[model samples]
Target: MTCFPVVCEVESVMLEMQDPKTGVKSQPQRLVITTIPHAITGEDIVAWLTNCYSIEAEEAWALGTMLVAFGYIYPLQDHKRLVIKPDASLYRFQTPYFWPAQQWPVEDTDYAIYLAKRNIRKKGTLELYEQVQYNSLHKWMNHKWDFIVMQAKEQYRAGKERKKPDRVVFDCQERAYWVVHRPPPGTVSAMDYGLERMVDPNTEELLFSCLFSLFSSLVKYSVTYNKHDPFLAPCLPSNPWVTDDVTYWLLNMANVEIPTKMRVERWTFSFGELLSDPRGRDDFRLFLKKEFSGENLAFWEACEDLKWGTAATMNDKAQQVYKTFLTRGAPRWINIDGKTMEVTVKGLKHPHRYVLDAAQTHIFMLMKKDSFGRYLKSPVFKDTQKRAILTTVENAQSKMGIIILKRRPSISPIIVRQLEQEERARMATSGPVDITQVMSKLSNKGKEVPPSKK
Candidate 1:
């Protein structure tokens, strides 16, 4: 469960010595405890708490403040600090594979030994299974969840391996992960692309569920410590409030149609596909144009072309691309954050291929989260998909014909007895003579002619 910091106000009243001297005189000292909350202006947390717990509270704060506070619920941060981006040094357990873990600094066996020692020290046991499981799952979730998908048509593409690529990718700009693999080798009867269309609160909830599950498993393997029997076995959170609200808010922000897939042999598609395909690119551009953000994709594509072009082309167009997209006053300037724009501009004096990486990544991601979802849902894409499906159905029906010829009758019990008898008679007349008769004929001919030859 996630934790969040909370603030509350407390009040105390004190009796002074003046009351003792008078034997009846009481001096009340109001002690105020500092804290805060949302409600009608000046309503402060103190009054809300008072009203919630005790009696009808009179409003002390101004009317404007009260209006601002009314019905404004605090947000949830249920996934706080769950995104564990460890530094290079601590990546000792996961630096081996280049497919999922991009960077490598050590050999596989060496890393295994390092993990063993590390786990034994920390967990008091040599069981590193959970660690590796989480390491892989976290890598998969953070990296590959977005890019992987299986298209039904790719199964028939000749020379395309039936095997899926063993890779996972986390596109930072897209804010999604994907696991790519080949679709199962067969004609797909029907396909359902259950693409995530909205932020899944359940994912965040499930993540904590898994975390607590792993934590419980780890505790089972723990050993006793000196002067204590280790500690009580860790248990799962019992209360919903145990989770942090800030994380949930952040996750909601991240997960919302941020153009978010994986598993069962996912297909990895390239942004180049988006840029190169005439129909696709034009459709996407049109969607962005409608949104008045067409320049973002245009700028991104230009940077990509410049980055991949020849050295001479890069040198010629680098300044133009930079000025057009990165500069503040330039025409068709994109809406990248200031930092990315500044970095891109700074590097324009002597531009290289990677100069626009930061800015391009930002724009690419901006389009992905901001416009990509809408593009998928746009009438253009829907109509295109509908047309494609209709075309496929037409082609299939035309090729196969309306009346499908079957090898057998529709009724299992119905039989043509006359046809069966005629087939048997035909086979009897046309089939080869028995092997016994052929051998007897040869024997008789040999007996009749061989006596004189001897």
Candidate 2:
């Protein structure tokens, strides 16, 4: 089966603290976590978010903006009252991003909504706890988050089993924070990247030291982003780098940190680096002027386009410059067939020949699941992992428990890995249209998928 890893960026930082607490300045720490099946997705997560956040339209907007301003992404939520345990992290991350909480399988969503509608008559549809179906589902739903507790009580008949009866206490009310607290505007601290700031010592003086270090760590023969190589990967804490094994491989990789003296002196990525900010960032745009003729016009243009945090793509020219520097000290035009998603590796070839350390990769996947939760859907993976994911999925699905393939497999993980280094000589390069969907198909090949053609 033809296959490769599903690599993409996932949101890492979350907004929790407000006002005096000032949530973490926020840094993107590289991590990996397990992908959960879709079974846990439901309204409990949604209800918790509503319970946690301010239901006021402006209140939610200010809250969401506070998060985005600190350099993490958050979405808008509509204002409504009567939310249940809103402090839940699942709801905090998913709600603003357009994930529908009510669509979740949890009946608590209906109950929560019922509680929110102040206009509903008390004895009508709004009368909660009386509905049979709602009560049943709510009871089951509540158990999902219920903590296991053991309690012991003393009995009058001493000496037998310590004369105590074990009892369990349900402290749901204490842990379930039903009330939402709305602080003033910019409730969360407008701090710098926390995780990086802790490590860098001078996160502000330097621009992207952590980022440069990470990219630098793996690139031995090359310099910057390789459009074909996974080295120049999408930025985020988890799956920052792409992988070939949809099961374990990843695309996680970036960060900010104290500017090294060298970075402070030479590579400071100031607001001026790509912006029109009066502090001088806008000057980077001078290359676009008719009179400017000192350096690379196209390269400089790319930098300017992304000055306001637009984001980076693998094949951009500046990254090409950096990658070119890393490889053979220069970039060269390689033969490429975009349609085929293939390219020839000359001296400047990049697709980072980097793979996570086995233990590190494993740890990273676990962490990724913590953030994206149920959105992730792969299993454990290794650089040596090479079952074409789909083949495994297909094998599991074969009605006879056996499926024949057009090609016999005989490559070692090591050999398969080395081949990944081969610069395909194709004049074109094209990846699967929908990498995630392709991954799902590969993982569930012949297995049972309600939506699958099988």
Score residue 318 of candidate 1 by CA lDDT.
Answer: 85
- Per-model lDDT: 0.40, 0.29
Cα lDDT tens digits for candidate 2, 1-454: 1111110011222334321243322222211232221111113333323355637544454444443333233312221221322232221222332211112232344333333321122334622323543345445544221110000111212223331111100111111111112112333333322222223344443446556676777684344223223355322222212321221122211122221121121212322222222212222223223233222333333333423333345345435544432234445221213311111122114322211112122333432333123112212111112221222223323422232333256679998776666645232254336689879988887676566585
Report the Cα lDDT for residue 408, model 1.
Answer: 34
- Worst lDDT window (10 residues) for model 2? 145-154
1-454 in candidate 1: lDDT tens per residue?
2211110011011011112342112222121231211111122332433343454343322221221111111111111111112111110011112212122232333333333333433463533443653355435433221111111112223213422211111111001111111112231211112121112335667577778899987665443221112134211111113322232233223223222111000111334445544446666776678778888888877877887899978877888886776666889977766655555666676677766777778887777666766766678655544443111224334334322342233543336677788899999889987999889999998878545665
In Å, residue 139's CA in model 1 sits off its true spot by 25
Write down the TM-score of every candidate: 0.31, 0.13
Give the poorly placed runs of model 2, Cα more than 4 Å off: 1-214, 217-454
Per-candidate alpha-carbon RMSD to the true structure: 26.3, 33.7
